[model samples]
Target: MNGDAVRVLTYNVRRDVASDGEFDWAARRDAVASTLRFHRPDVIGLQEPLAHQYADVRDALPAYEWVGQSRNADDGDGEFCPVGYRRDRFERVDAGTFWLSPTPEEPGSVGWDAAYPRIATWVRLEYRRSGERLLYANTHLDHESARARAEGAELLRERVQEQRENDEALVVGGDLNCLAGDEPHRALAGPDEESPLVDAREASPHPPHGPSTTRTDFEGLLPDRQIDHVFVAGCDVAGYGVAADVMGDGWFPSDHLPVVVDLEL
Candidate 1:
């Protein structure tokens, strides 16, 4: 990697569920780690992982450290959206989580017309090599409610605007459950001039690699459901891709493919 470049990956690991059968976490844990290891991301944002599931990945990637909390509990008991970074390369300045609701500070608060409570995890890090700081956030939006997703996007935008210091580079990523032209995407990366971020894929000079869509459903991939994305500010997108890696058994690591972006900060 170049001195100014950092690779970021956004993935939805799909919470451990027995109903997943052959694709269960116990069966694919190593595959998930292998995929991540192969990509060698400097920073990662993961969605839909329970505590145990996150722990499994954490164990495999010894170089990474993370910050996250469950959407349902302050003690980290439920599903989580976690942001992780290379500990040897970056020193964490601060970290926290906030619910995607009207009462953002209230843990487990449900927002809008959503069926489930959602949250975003964030971290402020200083790159050890360059001494540059970055504010990175990760989230999972409600799949069942358009209103919830749109409002959640606005809340994230507001928080990013409020917390950013001296225009330090910003990166926010997750399973937004919306397409490129969707309201939530528009809210974050707008045709309007005031948007704080832009889609990394759109900013890259080279075309994206791998499949156009990001969801695989374990059984097969869909053509139009590219819900995973990374948005950035004050950086240049050097490369972007959708990773469709699989284990030797031919099973994908999770239901959703990982989205990767190489950024020059």
Candidate 2:
């Protein structure tokens, strides 16, 4: 069998803070929801959504069931890196969250030179129609510290290698906070890394669609500044694109664009 086709979207939903003024989550929540709804991805990996904001997206996409936890240990009310999947398409075989720190098993642990705690959430699913297993992981690395980003990527790669079962297809997606040639990006997708993943954009047969950059900040669409990414292993990338849609008023749904990829696994 060629395996089942899966569509994945990785989005950094930009936290719901009042400082954004007109571009705050309150103003663009529906736009974000609509964007996800319109794309119809089988799985979505989201970063930077606060508890209530995650709730809004969850309520909006009732067809999807989600698994995640706040990155904070205190009251469990902080930014989340959640993984949501279509309930009818796959069965959740397993799921968990791990901090991107030297102490990965400890919740809310800060790693390297990071400005804040970072985490990766993952789920193992069984494609109902084919009984094929796939592992999908989502994360957001540190934005301010390059060292943190690199080490976090390495840690995630290690964890994925350790946990993934033999012959299972793999996918890793997120707003990785680094460009393609950067250390973090290389650590995850570079051939030198042990059991390295393939960047979906590079593996796809078709050219990437939309602007090159993934960060818009609700305004500028800089060229070749792409930071969002989706990487895979044991799959054929059928297509890749940067979802750069905006509202009629020209307001983007989030600061970062979603990276969408199609795969057969």
Instruction: Tell me the TM-score of model 1.
Output: 0.98
lDDT (CA) per prediction: 0.92, 0.92
- Which ranges of candidate 2 are over 4 A from the true structure? 1-3
47-101 in candidate 1: lDDT tens per residue? 9988899899899999999898899955578899988899988999999999999
User: For residue 149, what is the lDDT in candidate 1?
Assistant: 99
What C-alpha RMSD separates each model from the true structure? 1.0, 1.6
TM-scores of all candidate predictions against the true structure? 0.98, 0.97
Least accurate 10 contiguous residues by lDDT in model 2: 1-10
Report backbone clashes per prediction.
0, 0
| Model 1 score (lDDT) | 0.92
The TM-score obtained by model 2 is 0.97
